[model samples]
Target: MNTGGKFSDAELMEAIQKNEGKNDAIRFLYQEYFDSLSSLITYNSGSTEDAQDIFQEVIVSFVQIVQDGKFRGESSIKTFLYALARNTWLNELKRRGRMTQRNKLYEEGRDRFAVPPSEAFENREIRKQLLAAVGRLGESCRKILALFYYEGQSMKEILEQTSYENDQVVRNKKYKCLKQLADLINNDKIIAENLKQIDHEQGF
Candidate 1:
């Protein structure tokens, strides 16, 4: 694995180009970029599992770029890799119905060289508080809410997965758990401030 960040761009490209040492090249890429890329997803309302999934897709894309012979060495591998990861994550957010208008505008303006700040909606403090609030809920509430909201599962699906009597039971639990979370946020002055900033920045 490329554990020491000692691999050069040309060497990386070459490694990917050649069949030999290909797995090593992939391992090297994972060793180098996984943590940062995973954090990018996790901080943007994604769970660790979601981050892992996104990074796997990013690796596939990185490999394809190299194999296609279009890498061009135009930028450092890290820059290109990051651009790919961020774009992929943003698209994932959109597919999950998590992207807001602010995210849309931000995506439109993103540079190939840098990820913009996550303040508009995916605020770090907001993420932190949300996780905390959810953690404070009972296990049933947490599981139900995560399934319905984060996992985007339907009430029927949730009913099948849980011990609920029916879809209505699942729906009621979700509503109450979400309400509890909203109350938590309402009580947290810092979270409220961060949310206000998000709306203001997004021109909402």
Candidate 2:
């Protein structure tokens, strides 16, 4: 079950689960699938950068599915991934206030493999809004927040990875970044509306 760097379905699942052939597996997945997935996003009124983010979300979802023993191999991994990417993008469009029938149009004639969509790794609406707020930050704060929050690195790990002087400094920077993000969120009417909508949905 070896040809160049492509993994068979079984090998892909094993590589993701065991972390041994993981790097090669991921690299091959990206090399083989990024373009097609990204094109799907771009064709659906999203930008190139949006495509990148959607693909990253797709990969995160796929990896989680593999790790959690949810990938039952009823379909090939490629088909599963494509369906997952499509569903993930559809979810994003709905979140952005788009209620288009184009999603139905796209799904109408596809051989949507039996593998279901998994959003286990996609950000919830609130967190996604906060990420947008964070994206509005300047370079340093963005990096700090990304390293600390998104990457889930420890303070010590971040200190080693970044150029901060010490833990206190890093904490201070993170605090400032959080405050700035809060201010940004507060200032955005759309984000505030989204928060309220989330709360309403949750019966808050």
Candidate 3:
């Protein structure tokens, strides 16, 4: 079976299980599987951002399972990853109370690859609006928000990544940037409806 990278399936599994070159293995997984797994969400009732978040969650869970010796290798890694992504996305949809007809069909073992035209359009609009909102932010604010939220960097890490003098400065800047982003998002009804969860998640 093609493993989609320099490492074969067994090689990747061994690296993960033994904690040897595991970072490389994980990076390989990201490059090889992210597009396929993320499409599982984006083609469903999820945005690109949602797909990215779910993929990250799935990678963490997969690493843990491997370390715990729970991955029996009964299935190919690709199959296992797709299963994880599907289940994770389904649970997210349930949590958001967005189990639409397509989702119901997915649960019933129907084809879920078909993207509804309206959902595609709405996803495009949401991306456009979000980019516009981010563009309105000052360069420093934009960098701070991107590092904290999108890259999941801590204040200390942000300080190291940027020219900030200390953690306190990074934290203060991040808070202000998040507030500005929230304000921009709130001003647009469509963007607000799509991204309202960020405010709660970021402790705004």
Candidate 4:
């Protein structure tokens, strides 16, 4: 009955299914994941309490998968947990109607399918840069880009919202806005300096 052996996740899952070793197994999971998940949630605009709630929900989903024999072996347990937690948080944000592009990008990065670490990092950085660039755009351009990309609005929809006379006008405005945003990212030396400071502080 020594439950201290480092059981493979499969062994622990079997015990969980049998209802004989769930507490110890779950305890191990809590001790292992609580802090990391808390940091992730907090960084994604959640409070500590929100983090706890999401982590509990994640545990419930994980348990359900184990009980129902749906724990596929294609992804590692860590990847599965991250995906479930991220999606749970994103759903919470959507329910509140406060889904930010940053949050959307983060969940997209955490997706278990079709993402490698390098690409994920690159995507995350690019999104951050893009957001900063958007912040610098004029109000009209900013609104246009937000409507077009964030709201998934078509050119006609954008024309109506922006009071543009035609689809061609809206399309041209979008192109200029995108170019301005790109230029902002390129010309904003402050961001580059801040990045250097961050790298130095992080010892990277």
Candidate 5:
């Protein structure tokens, strides 16, 4: 079994199809594609948590198709995975009854104009307030938020940085930290006013 640091697409497919080094193949998928695949969800009004869930589903479906001898090697694995991720996320949005809203947001993103000076100034102010709120969180919460949101570290990467026993532990801690941050932001009068004003301006 070739358990080297890298695998060509053909090597990965063969490993997966034969169930030889399948675990390593899956890990390779995560390491090579998680960030980009998850971006599809995140950019479409989905949370990082949502992205993670969708990517897991994509992996499961991809493996099954490969093992069933249904995945013809016409398209590259990267392209196939991307299509699977997109379709899965679209189905999820439809299931949640948010497909229409998602389309509206996508259109707005496509047709948006450049930011005006006033809106830009307001955005900067809002960011400052948000950063201040994050700063006020406890040390653990601050570290988790900074690593995940600011530094773009994966949960597994965060597990390496923190003392967490596993990725699930890191995820739970991160979720609690996010809830704490949200509560803190909601309870702050000034920040609440700023958020409201921004939402109003954005026609939300």
Candidate 6:
């Protein structure tokens, strides 16, 4: 079978398992799968950078299964990948406190895709406000926010990424950056009104 056009997970696996050089097969999978996966992450409280990091982790996990010869073909490749990506995103959301364990468990039980409501207009507005506030933040502040919240990097990892001498320094910096962002949002009357409108719509 041609290694293109969303190969059945079986077909992709067969090719991957048997092809002496299945780099093209792997590349085809990435091209077809990356956008959908990235969009799913972005829709569920992730930024573009968040999307990239999660997708990369998913790919790594997929490859590990293949290399270990542990894929049993019990599920289609796409289905398996979808499940893996969803679980990863849910775990990330939970870690961030954006979602609770109950919501994650509920989502795991459902065959259907759970999406944020179209009526969550206020959340969208808040995201816009938050992003604007983030933009106004200094470079160090922005980097800290992006690394911890957006990239899902741990504080230890962030410490390494930020060139901070220690975790305590990083923690203080993150608090300051978040405070700065909060202050900007609080001071902006228009954003506050928009947020209020959204809160009202959500009956919060």
Query: Largest TM-score belongs to which candidate?
Result: 2
- CA shift at 156, candidate 3, in angstroms? 21
Q: What tens digits encode model 1's per-residue C-alpha lDDT throughout 104-142?
A: 765785564443344223464575577688788899999
By TM-score, the better pick of 1 and 2 is 2
Candidate 1: 10-residue stretch with minimal lDDT: 113-122
**What ordering of candidates by TM-score runs from best to worst?**
2, 3, 4, 5, 1, 6
Prediction-by-prediction clash tally:
0, 0, 0, 0, 0, 0
User: Could you tell me how far off, in angstroms, the CA of residue 90 lies in candidate 6 after the best superposition?
Assistant: 1.5
Whichever of 1 and 5 has more lDDT, that candidate is 5
Index of the highest-lDDT prediction: 5
lDDT of 3: 0.77
Which whole-number lDDT from 0 to 100 does residue 32 have in model 5? 98
Error of 5 at 97 (Å): 0.7
Q: How well does candidate 4 match the true structure in TM-score terms?
A: 0.52
Clashing residue pairs in candidate 5 (N, C-alpha, C atoms within 3 angstroms) = none
Clashing pairs in 3: none
lDDT of 5 by residue, 65-173 (tens): 7887777877788988887777667657755777776565654433122212332334444655777898999998899988999678999899988898999998999
Candidate 2, 45-161: lDDT as tens digits: 789998999899778778878988888888788788888887777778776877578766875654455545224213345557766887789998888888888678888988997
lDDT for model 5 comes to 0.79
Whole-model lDDT values for every prediction: 0.76, 0.77, 0.77, 0.74, 0.79, 0.71
Ten contiguous residues minimizing lDDT sum, candidate 5: 110-119
Which ranges in model 3 have alpha carbons more than 4 Å from their true place? 1-5, 110-204
TM-score result, candidate 1: 0.50
Q: Estimate each model's TM-score.
A: 0.50, 0.58, 0.52, 0.52, 0.51, 0.45
How does candidate 1 score on lDDT? 0.76
Error of 5 at 49 (Å): 0.6
Model 3 lDDT, residue 156, Cα = 84
Error of 2 at 125 (Å): 3.5
TM match of model 6 to true structure: 0.45
Q: Number of clashing pairs, model 3?
A: 0
| lDDT (10s digit) by residue, model 4, range 1-204 | 227546567766777777667778787778878898878899999999999988987787678677777776577767777777776777678757898888878766656552233223323345456667777789999988888886688988888777788999889989998998878887867666656655676699
